[model samples]
Target: MAQIDWETLAGRVENAPSLLRLWDALEDYAQACRDVGCTEAECGLDLRRLPTYGGEWTGEYLFPIRDDGITIRSHDETHMLLDRERAEPRYVVVPRSAYNL
Candidate 1:
């Protein structure tokens, strides 16, 4: 799995508070995976109907971990990023999808 830098992520979603919590959650999930001896690629955490942008939007956070990186995606038209460590969790905030449907 790939790793990411937290500072860079904090830059992108600095205004999105919920994403910060989501970031912490992702970290916990990653740690849990390590504790269980599961590969990050095989790990996932599905967040259903999470509130974002101060209730302006609500969507699911689909976290699919991979050997190369981890994706923090929303079921709606959005996504964000959070990082771990060297070459084990490179994160990327996938810009919001253009289509609503």
Candidate 2:
């Protein structure tokens, strides 16, 4: 797996227009990785392992977005979630098809 530069990612996220667009960029990157035959683990772009608020792992790619103290909701439809008020976030690009799963 490739090492992530948290500081760099924080900067990018801070400057990004929206989390959804950032997710798109990640999806593109993951596609490029697969084009070269890199596995999700080897490419270090597994969305399932992404970190979430309070130092928790997502376990799956899509989940819910809740307020600082509210409960998280799970949706059956495919989409990406973002929490800007929590600790700094880290993300990776996965194919769009990953969202359908």
Candidate 3:
């Protein structure tokens, strides 16, 4: 597979019509990175450039791990995206580990 431009993916997520689509695309990307054996550094997303809102959305929503060693807290943008009260979805570039894929 060709190297996916992070900027392009970020743009797509930003323009996505809904949160569902954003998550779908992000999940797919995470899978692709895993398939290609991407390193953690290579698979990380720049969270600062993504959108965020107010709320508490845990990382467990995306990656559920029972181990006590693992702590899942939603990234700022993810927190906003997970907000049930928000009509519009937010976007964020989370690391591969964040997805736990």
TM-score of each candidate? Answer: 0.36, 0.32, 0.40
By lDDT rank, best first, the candidates go 3, 1, 2
Between candidates 2 and 3, the one scoring higher on lDDT is: 3
TM-score of 3: 0.40
Estimate the TM-score for candidate 1: 0.36
For 12-77, candidate 1 gives per-residue lDDT tens digits of 333335655555555555565677676444544333333344323444444444553443443223
Considering every candidate listed, which one attains the maximal TM-score?
A: 3
lDDT string for model 3 (1-101, tens) is 57767666656655555455656565565555567787323766543243433345544343323433232223444332332212222223344345443
TM-score, structure 2 vs. true: 0.32
Q: lDDT for model 2, on a 0 to 1 scale?
A: 0.41
Report the lDDT tens digits of candidate 2 across residue range 1-101. 67555445434433345445555455455455557686434655444434332222346434433445211212122333432324433333332244443
Better of 1 and 3 by TM-score: 3
Model 2 clash pairs? 26-93
- lDDT, model 3: 0.45
